[model samples]
Target chain A: MTEKPMNAVSNEAVDSCGCGCGREDLPWSGRGTDLPITGCRFSLYPMTDDFVSIILGALDKTDTSHVWCQSDALSTVYRGKREYVVDAVAALFANAWREGVHMALEGQISRGCPGDVSGDSVLSCEGEAPNASIVAAATQPALAKLSLYPLGVENYIDDIAKVWYRAEELGLNPTSIHYATRVEGSIRDIFAYFNDVCALMERTVSHYVLHFTINVNSPTDEEE
Target chain B: MTEKPMNAVSNEAVDSCGCGCGREDLPWSGRGTDLPITGCRFSLYPMTDDFVSIILGALDKTDTSHVWCQSDALSTVYRGKREYVVDAVAALFANAWREGVHMALEGQISRGCPGDVSGDSVLSCEGEAPNASIVAAATQPALAKLSLYPLGVENYIDDIAKVWYRAEELGLNPTSIHYATRVEGSIRDIFAYFNDVCALMERTVSHYVLHFTINVNSPTDEEE
Candidate 1:
């Protein structure tokens, strides 16, 4: 696979420097999904002795044909259009879940990063999401911590505060902490909340990221 | 607690809007530890049926007197000076570790965020780190995925590339992915590598973040 220059928001050619230097003329607010590259790096941890099997089995069951995926010892990365990346990841988690085992997954999803244009080949694979059936099969309550970074925005805190407000309005129980907002609900609602926030931000911000850690099937604890 | 203005790198007071509005006079590279505020939000997950006991017991054993801590259902947050924040978190994780059970801790340690000035009260606490002994007592090899965000930098990829290069030089077996760089080593080494990278970035970027997930005592997986 050869590195190719993808069009910036202004349809300008970006430099191989991977810094959007040539695209400086385009206003940061002008960015959108017009740049089709999106990326997610995630690691799943199943708290059972059979973790290796659960992890590998989930990978085998999930269809990642639509995205470019690379798995290393520490984590797995999926890069492509936003929908395909999220679909593959959601299905991976659903397939990994076992009723009695506690599990957690940590990941970061980022879009419109200037450096991410190198792997644009995967965006060509276009069709409906392949893993919808698997994601529909799993429905579990999860506790999540989400931190949003609206990079390149001058008033980033405002963007975060707005998102937090919406999360509260949606009854996600968003409690503000130092670096993140805690939300508790079904996996579907949690994921939808994130998608909503990202959709809202896509109208303006160029480079944005959401970092989330989700835990499921925890042993009941009175202290928490 | 009432909110108060803190001095920015230029010694200018930040606006109450929490978006570095009044401090545009300062160059981003001019920022350093002179700001005297840091923040960390972390969660510990133990993969056992008796997780409640292990988690609560760890919190009870660890001391958070030197930093500001807030615990919610999803996670715990600590904010103060950089050393104190790290000390509290590292000690918390060390205290939480139990032999023969798989456990994971995820956290974000960030410095120089402009909106972080609201909690400066905790910075006045003085003295050496309170939990150094606890951190020294625990030494477990861990596998970690670390993602650094040098916010507000024009050439952010360059900053990340530099950190990845150093991780390789330190024999951390760094692997680059779409959104993060993975490193495998002891917990102490992983934390140290992050500290080293943050120190290097302190010279230039005013706002930066390091997000990490560490897993220990995993049931050996042959696939990995």
Candidate 2:
């Protein structure tokens, strides 16, 4: 079989951090002043009933601390430190599954570089953001996209739109039916997020015979 | 928002049924001689680790009655009556999730047409295949594609290759890194499968955090 490079296609839009942190100018060692970050862009599709409330309910239940979570009619995007975002996703899927909700999710997880950092005002964190020391010791940031589909839901457009409205109210321009976000941080953090997200999706959706996929890219400084 | 037709793109390969059943010649009403079928084509990606035996172990635990299931290194494929196939996937994912294995999956669920019926020996069923009357009352067949990514597992290529060998032994091409399949039957059967599969996946994989996606298509005779 042909071993194709996973990240051959670069379709996602990468915008500079709006905070004007000059995140890119920071040293690769992350020692002087720049703090490394982990981020992701994701979307979830509920395949069962099309009631908009289910999607909205799940989004509402999620904890956004350490992650900037936003949704549009098509999907939701989460960006922030890798650990908290992963935890948030785990909590979201667990609650949905316990409530017998069926849905599918798609996401891109990454670290080592800054992703779309616009709208940091809505960002919530348990404590102060990471410092240069945290970045210096962390692994190179990486990126990956994942998907999960719980079977049985249909006519989800209305519900998706409702969530989109909420995101719009939060000042996010969630206009695309196809949701995309950028993430940057240590490779370990990204992998951790990837692993945790996959685990949760599998546990919840697999029992229902749902199908899912994940493509990961961990770029090193040499590769960059 | 623009309401785009879901199945606007036709990239998947479609082949005629080899059973000489003349399924297409049958009336759209599915009344006298033809039994409508619901079918799905799917692939699973174990995102956590690369242990092939674990994935095979999960597949080994599945019940194929009412569906034809196959796998290669890259992914697994299931086809058959919607109800049976759905049941089988639910069982498979549930067992895997309980075992704490993480993986992702991709699938296509479709009705109104038969797909890749060339190999029928591998077909497994609890009772006889559907009769003409059963097909007659069944709704038009529908199809969809889905995905699930169980988090934490990694290095799955070796394990995938091991599965590929099994598919090759069964006479499947089983070479490409990408996996795709097809299913056919009534919409009810397909929906049943979808709901059950999602439920099972959710129940099994939720604790670990997984990601997934599913796209469905149910076509009426009029649309054709």
The segments of candidate 1 whose C-alpha lies over 4 angstroms from its true place after superposition are A1-35, A156-171, A219-224, B1-35, B98-101, B137-139, B155-173, B201-203, B218-224
For DockQ, the strongest prediction is 1
The pairs that clash in candidate 1 are none
Per-residue lDDT for A1-224 in model 1, tens only? 11111111121232212222112222322132346677777878776656667877888889999998766445677878677788888888888888867788888877776545564338787778898777666568888877676666555445556676777777787654455556777776676676677676676578677888887875544232
Distance (Å) between predicted and true CA of A171, model 2? 40
Candidate 2: DockQ? 0.02
At residue B66, candidate 2 shows an lDDT of 61
Candidate 2 chain A lowest-lDDT run of ten: A215-224
Which fraction of the native contacts appears in each prediction? 0.10, 0.00
DockQ, every prediction? 0.13, 0.02
Q: Residues B124-222, candidate 2, lDDT per residue (tens digit)?
A: 455633332333343543332222222122222232233324334433222111111122334345434344443343333221111223222211111
* Per-residue C-alpha lDDT of model 1 across residues B1-224, encoded as one tens digit per residue: 11111111121222212222112222322122346567777777776655666777788787888887766545666778677788777777778787777788888877775545564338777887898777766678777767666666555445555676777777787654455555777666676676677676676578777788887775544232
